[model samples]
Target: MTTVERTQVFLLPDLGEGLSEAEIVEWRVAVGDIVTVDQTVVEVETAKAVVDVPCPYAGRVVALHGAAGEIRPVGQPLITIAPLDGDGGAGDEPAGHATYREEERAGSGNVLIGYGTGHGGSGRRRRRPRLAVAGEPPAAVGTGAVAQTDPTGPADAAPAGTGVTASPGSSPALVISPIVRRLAKERGVDLASVRGTGLGGVIRRADVEAALADAAAPAARLAAVPDAPEAHVGLAPAGDGDVVIPLTGIRKAIADKLSRSRREIPEVTIWVDVDATALLETRAAINAATPDAPVSILALLARICLSGLRKYPQLNAHVDTEGQRIVQSAGVHLGIAAQTDRGLLVPVLRDAQRLTTRELAAELAATTAAARAGTLPPARLTGGTFTLNNYGVFGVDGSTPIINHPEAALLGVGRIVDKPWVVDGQLAVRKVTQLSLTFDHRVCDGGVAGGFLRHVADCVEQPALLVANV
Candidate 1:
């Protein structure tokens, strides 16, 4: 008979995003799997994004408290581990020392920074651990580093708690969305004066618009100048006085998505010009009929593209890497490249082709609202058959949008501008918009992608052609 000692580990406070709960996306280590401290053990999805949680103590994984996709609360036992002893077999420890001494604990002390790694287990506790709380994964930290200590406390160990540290200041700096930051940078508006109405009092796109609107308020009551101070940090370079902007949260997400797309997918782009007179007129008519409906150019473009997707099934396809096959979708789930304050977010409209023009407009409005609010569910932002980016809204002529990886293609719609064209052998003014379609050339050849774009432009140019097909 063999005797062994087991210990339970509790979930820490700031898993990330200051969230109290998190959904377990995956368990990297299962029961009985040997795991070292600081190794990634599980992946969790919070409200904002997916993150990986690391092991707190170095030991053998004895148990997992929850299954994948299960919501767990913070300060609960996530996993139990069997600590290694002198008699512990000659198992494996990487080419490094594995020491277990009382060190500083997580979520203790002066202030809480964003979710990074925390301190360690206190005084060799052999108590039961709790489940993980609902929250984002702790922010990524450097390898094998412990949270710094609090000299004021006794040289023991920090006790188990939520592990989420709170901000020290009364009015901690306002949190601004990616879209708000972009608009502010472009328009030279101060974000400090803008009152945030978002979750956790975060600054939002609407807040920036409100601040811009109040720019003419009485000088005495005016809000303090925004972002200018940060911008003017240097007139002339001083002893390496560089500004350190932290990249975490939404900015981190944007970097990951773009990097993944470029690294994993082979992309090719094709461009064409489409007559937009009918599309514009059609939108105007729809708006007049339902004054309350927020019918915009996006709705018309989405409908046209959805129709084209049904006609060209190959364009509405996804690469199945494991299956080693191309999966042509039977239905169209269109992702609109929505530019928000916190960067680019693509909210999908499921079975888009099945919906009417008004429904498309309504879904677009709802999805965009959810995205900008940072309340969009992870599922709504995932699994798209195709994507559409309206560079036209920004008054841009044309652009080659990167293909959303896994999906075969993305369509970029340019701004509609008046141009002279031959009509009845005579030059006439016509509304024209350029369309740039970038696809994964590996999945679809240039001939097929080109034909698809040409067909889509034809539908937009003569929307009546769609009526004929229907």
Candidate 2:
């Protein structure tokens, strides 16, 4: 019996939560390897979390579209697979076309965005909208092709160089990725002048970088001339020995978020030093009673925070700038700020108010560990109502950290150390720690913020206050 096989292209699925792109961290499979349906093929890092992307089709891998560390937009081809027949022979139909038909019939499973198995709902996949350039016609549908038009007449097209193929026409330069456009804009490079070497004449990030490098020499020469304008003087180029690192992945995400917070939120910080001796003693006593389940200082502080939020619900809310309202959360989703090698990650414990002290401790410890290991899903990394930052673990006295964006407040704990304290009019050594609350001024004034911090301090100073309140 004759057998035939056709190649199927797997586009990168929507990694969830409206994420547009992901950086490829590692590829688990290579060309010529047979991958089963739902088999993990590549690991990608989005702005929110690291994810293991599974292949929806079972077949022999024909191609891997991206290298590790490359950022691929969603809906871009990720992997190409050739499905094998029962006799292990190739299919009669063309490699690419037959796969699309098969995809329509069998569906690409529930993992991808556009196509899904017919368990429920429509099986048709949605396509990403194409970015239209000047003089370009509306993009053709259902075909993975970009419409390119040269601004200069085709007869006057310039010779291709450095990945740029300039042609004479009335259309603007063909650029795809927004990252490329942003880079060009920031560097003052004219996109209309730079040609695209990417598929279908799309200008890519590399092309913009090349343009920037080519312009650097002439700009420097012009600046070196005597009596020359000092406009670009302060912009020092990197030295040969200097290691210039590009901000990408988690670092870029952090920069964008913190920048947005600074730009939008009107934040205020207030701090107080608390005697944590009683809190420590209470933890030790509880741990001694339940040796199997030891509660951490962070968990105790988290419990204190939950109580404070209950009293001052204003701080437990975020500002909806679009609606011009303070949107308070119904439940406490506690975000624990954890520093990881990848960057700063905040893994949240959902409905934290519902958990007991021991349960909070377990979840906090596990979530933090998973965050540092880069194993937590994207869902676990977002939707936090408030953030808890234990900067004390770094042995620091205090910090005024930026509030995690959208969240109304962040509680920062400094290092706990022995300090002189007055007990019953006598001075004695006690465990002292600084607690700082940075809150959004738009949510509440200093009155509410101070009340919340003071309540937290009261709990730390006298554990009985928390017990009584509970």
Task: Report every candidate's CA lDDT.
Answer: 0.62, 0.73
Weakest lDDT window of 10 consecutive positions for candidate 1: 157-166
As a whole number from 0 to 100, the lDDT of residue 259 in candidate 1 is 86
lDDT of 1 by residue, 381-460 (tens): 77888999988899999987777767889999888899997777999899999999988876778888888888888888
| Candidate 2 lDDT by residue in tens digits, 90-189 | 3333243333445433535757532223433223222232332533332111122221224343332211111122235734676545446445543445
| Top TM-score hit | 2
| Candidate 2 deviant stretches above 4 angstroms | 1-5, 91-108, 112-240
Backbone clash count, each prediction separately:
28, 13
Give per-model CA RMSD.
14.3, 12.4
Whole-model lDDT, model 2? 0.73
